[model samples]
Each structure stands twice: as C-alpha cells, then as structure tokens.
Target: MKKRSWFAVLSLALVVALVFTVAAGCSKPSKQPTIDKIKKRGVLKVGVKADVLGFGFMNPATKQYEGLEVDIAKRIAKDLLGDSKKVEFTAVTGKTRMGVLDNGEIDMVIATFTITEDRKKLVDFSPVYHVDGIQFLVKKDSGITGLKDTDKKTIGVAKGSDTQDRLAEQAAKLNIKPQFASFETYPEILAALQSGRVQVFATDGSVLKYYESQDKNTVILPDKYSSEEYGVATKKGNDDLRDFVAKVINNMVSSGDLAALKRTWGLGK
Candidate 1:
C-alpha cells in the first residue's frame, strides 16, 4: 500500500511537471518586438495613395494595386516576410493618411508623403525617397500660363497638403493673391478643375501628370516650384521599423533598383 501511494505521488508530480513544460513552451514574452508581431500576423500593413497613378493607384478592372510606391511597400514586405504578396495596402489621402498611421491602423505610410518640419513633429520620416515639385493643372483654354496669371483665380489643393501653404507663400512673393479651395482627395481637386469650380488644380507635379492623362483638355503648367521631398513615414517612437525601412530604401537607391522602378512607372525625370 505504501509503494502504491509513492507511485501515485510520483505520477502526479510528473503530470504537473509536464503541464508546466508545455505551458512554458507555448508562452510568449510580455512584449514582442515589432518585427515578431508582424511575422506572427503574417501581413505587413501599408498606407498608399489610391488615386495617384504611377506613384500609387488601384487598378479598378484587375482590383489590384500597381505603382512605384506600391512596389516599394511590397519590397519591404518581401525583405521582412520573405514574400512580396504578404503586404496589405490601405488607401489613404493627404488628409487621412496621418490619422490612420497615428491610429495604428497601418504599419507605415508610403503615400506621396512629403516631408516637412511641421509633419516631422507628428511622425518619423525615412530618407527622402523621391523629389517632386508643386505644379498646376488647368484647362488649356483657361488662358492661365503662370503664377502671375493666377491672381484672384481659385486654386484647388488637397486638404492637409503642403501645397496650400506653399502656394500661398508663392502668391505672396509674386504679390498675386490667388483664392484657395481645399478638397479631400486628388480626384476631387481634378474634378473641381474640370467643372470650373476652381480655376487651377495644384499639387505635386508628378501627381498632376496622372490627372492630365485622364483629361485631354487639361494641361500641366511648366511652372514647377516648391521642392517636395517625398519620404516614407513611420509611427512616432517606432525606431526599429523606421531604421529597417531606411536600410531597405538605401539598398534600393544604391543598386539602381529604385531608378529602374522610376523608369518603369515613367517617373524618371
């Protein structure tokens, strides 16, 4: 009877030990690294422009995204997750991208997000990936050739974009006060331009090109100004992710892969 009691106690201890061993094996640490979280989730989330063709546009017929920025996001995913298609893209506009990033709805933003001192306070930016300039799109028959001709004309710019402030500063320098109208998206600005609700549609020159291609009557002004340095944006305090993104961008720039993407998208200047 004593021997049977000893065996029962031993078996109970062994079962307890096995339970603890299994629990320890399955347990995760209190805090996991950002990369590990992404790996476990099996998808890298990125915000990109849905309307800006060549930079980031969603092809309606194919229901897939294809653009330079989209490719960049995919490249990042490929390096981190070992598969380019492991990325999920969320469409964002100038007015909404930052909000989404701040809310943790996206891991990062690859939209044509221009780096500015004011924006730096909100999020960290990767190295300048692309350089662009603000330009105008107008009907060829509008008789508006340049900033000098835009005095008192209504200019359409995206809400929460740097274009408005830059345009105002330029207008002040030229001593020509152009009235400004703000829209939520690039497409809305283009539509306002077509409907004559605003005399000019203004944003980054590359973005204007896509709109111009869509409308045969519209022409982009040659007066490109306000150097807009585009960068990838990561959430504030996300140093690891930001550093990784910077490394990837540096590699692309060095290997001429970025230039190749630019040429493929007709973004090469």
Candidate 2:
C-alpha cells in the first residue's frame, strides 16, 4: 500500500510539470502590436472614398478602384508586405471613415481626410499627404462668379462634412445668407448641381475639378475659400500605425511617386 501511494504522488507531480511546460510554450509574452497583426493577416485594410473622382472613385466600366488615394493605400500595402494587391478597400464617406477608424475596423484611412484640430482629438493623422482647398462648381452658363453673388441663392454641400463648417465660416465673414442643400453623397451633390437645384456646388478643389472635367458645361469657379490639409488617419493612440503611414508617405513624396500618382489621376500641379 505504501509503494502504491508513493507511485501515485510521483505521477501527479510529473503531470503538473508537463502541464506547466505546455502552457508556457503556448502562451504569448504580450499582446501583438498593430503592425504585427496586419502582417500576420497578410492584408492591409484601407478606407477610401467610393465617389469623389480624382481622389477616390470606382470605375464602373472596369469595375475597379482607381485614384490618388487608392494608389497611396496600395503603395502602403506593397511597401509593407511586398505586394500591392494584398489589401482590402472599404468604401467610406466623409463621416463614416472616422467611426470605422476609431473602432479598429480599418487598418488605416487614405480617404482624402482633412486634418484639423478637432479631428486630431479623436484620431491621429499622418503628416500632410496632400493639400487641397474648398472651391465652387457651377454651370458654365451660370452668371455666378464668386461667393459674393450668392445672396439668398442656394448652395449645395455634403452633409456631415468639413466643407459644411467652412461654408458656415464663409457665410459669417461675407455677411451673406445663402440657402443650403445638404446632400448625403458626392454623386447626389453633382446631380443637384447639374439639375440647377443649387446654384453652387462647393467642396474640395480636386473634387470640383473632377466634376468640371466630366462635362464642359460644368465649370469649376476660381473661388478657393479655405485651405484643407489632407492626411492619412489611424485610430487614436495608434502610434505604430501612424509611424508606418508617415514613413510610406515620406518615401513616396521623396521618390516622386505621389506626384506621378496625382498626375495620373489629373490632380496636383
């Protein structure tokens, strides 16, 4: 009976040792960082505009995405993983990109996102990737030359957009009250502008240029009211991802890749 009892005690000690060995081998020392998580997944998820030509747009004919912002996102994936196609593009609007980025739904955002003091409080922005300003789009035949002419006239702006704020400031400064037509999407704004429902379609110059390019009758007015600084965005406190974004953008700018991309998309001088 004493020998049997001793043998049972030895087996229990051996089992405990084996269990601890396995646990130690299986456990991680700490949680994985954001970069590691992206690399492991083998795909970088990016948020980009689905409309807003020249910046981020999906070509319906080819059923493919193309634009300066799309190129930036793909370049980031290529530089990081050595493959550009290893990325997932999520269509995001001006308002929705922030929520997904804040919730970690996307790895990064290259969606013509403007960098502002208020936005900086919610999420981190990379160094200025591009600079654009608010401009106006009007039909070529329309007599409206600038903001001064719009006295009680209707102007179209995207809902939940930075342009809305700029428009408010402009109204306050000019001391002119213009009716506002708030649309949910850029296409809707374009439609409204084309239909003459609104006398002015105001947004980023790049976007306004796109609208002008599509039809000769549509003219992009020269009134650039506000300077907007565009930046890549990441979740707040995501220093690692922010650093990665900055490095990619810096290299692209130095190598002239960004310039080439903009030229291809018909943006940037």
Best by TM-score: 1
- Per-residue C-alpha lDDT of model 1 across residues 34-123, encoded as one tens digit per residue: 677788999999999998889999999999999999999999999999999999999999989998987678999999999999999989
* Candidate 1 wrong stretches, greater than 4 Å: 1-32
Off by over 4 Å in 2: 1-31
lDDT of each: 0.91, 0.85
Error of 1 at 116 (Å): 0.6
**TM-score for each predicted model, relative to the true structure:** 0.87, 0.84
Whole-model alpha-carbon lDDT for candidate 2: 0.85
In Å, residue 14's CA in model 1 sits off its true spot by 57
